[model samples]
Target: MPFKASGRATDYRAIDRFDGGAGWIAHPEETMQRASHVLRASGGEADGGAWVVDPVNADGVDDLLAEFGDVRGVVVLMDRHARDAAAVADRHDVPVYVPSFVDPDVDAQTQPLGGTLPDSDYEVVRTVDWPGWDEAALSDGETLVVGDAVGTTEYFRAGGERVGVHPLLRVKPPRALRQFRPERILTGHGEGVLTDATRALQDALDGARRNAPEVWLNGLKALV
Candidate 1:
């Protein structure tokens, strides 16, 4: 789906929140549509350093920092998903990592996502030739964290059931993402897949491939 203006967007309330074993994900209220995530190294690393992804609620900042220990980095998945990132970064005195292709409108200083993560636990992959946005995802070999280049809203189910790509993204799934065999997927929108992540990703890609017309129509609507 095209990015809807925030004015028309519903306020998200938390629905599900948990540590995805290897990582932590906080689902936005009510909808499995969006979330704030923290990617950390195994064994909790001594420094507790972590990368924050597309944070939304400022009221929960203290709790997030507490859980993650220290914010080594703040990342905005796409320009549209920069919500609360500036505030969160400023609160922790860290730089916001954005895609290199577009100018970030947030107040904080911005750095390119590449090789900027506090540790090597995560890698940023930019989605090339994506329509109307410069998008990216964070991967740690076993997990993939994303804002919206891919999503699970369309396929969401109760009890943390696995979901597929955002309806809009089914038109053109990025090959960069397809290459990763993530065991879990932490998504900005949609409840995350805590199990069978690699298979879930492949399923999402297959669903997109089968829904080419729906994807094309969504893309055209965004243009109009």
Candidate 2:
């Protein structure tokens, strides 16, 4: 894949696949694409215009954007070690959201490199303060994007689904890929276009209301 501009080569790896609600695993057929990332529309026709999440490698933003032809907005999630997502978002005309407290301007140059984020790029305010983690809005179907506020990884697995973070990267549980209970998932580099992901996500939301409240609070705590 083509790079964004010209400069230092950023460290980026591609996993095989990412399936929200189902899980993630390696694509034995294809080799990982570390130099670039990818994204696709999820939710289908009923979704109207929901898109999947994608994490582009260093200088790989252009390749990811090519899929959209031209997009409206992108919710950016910054990982502690991910590349400067804001610049990528800014360059693409999308708005990047950090863990509530992250400064788009300052952080645009601080993130380290190599990691995953809440695939969604929009903000799901649930609170009033900054937290180490937060959600992003990428696809419609009531989808929420998760940033690297929590962790990073190459592949994701759960329930019955399996997908890689990109092309060449493989995620290790507990560390690389932070297993989530999302109804549908959009990786920092790719998006999950599920047909019934909304319902699944809604259930997760309701469940969070019942149990994840404290986790959300923890994020709020981090912001302060």
Best by lDDT: 1
**Tens digits of per-residue lDDT for model 2 on 48-138?**
2322233333544354445444433333343232343455556665544344443333344333211223333333432112354323322
lDDT of 1 by residue, 1-224 (tens): 33332322233344234452222233333333457776654435746676677876534445545664677777887878777788879888989988776555788988876643556567777754555767777776777777775666543321232555555555566777778888777777766777788887776676765765654554455446
Clashes by residue pair, model 1: 1-168, 13-28, 13-29, 13-30, 14-28, 14-29, 32-190, 33-189, 33-190
Candidate 1: what lDDT? 0.62
Where does candidate 2 stray beyond 4 Å? Answer: 1-56, 59-61, 71-74, 78-82, 93-139, 142-144, 148-183, 189-224
What's the residue-level lDDT of 184 in candidate 2?
Answer: 51
lDDT of each: 0.62, 0.33
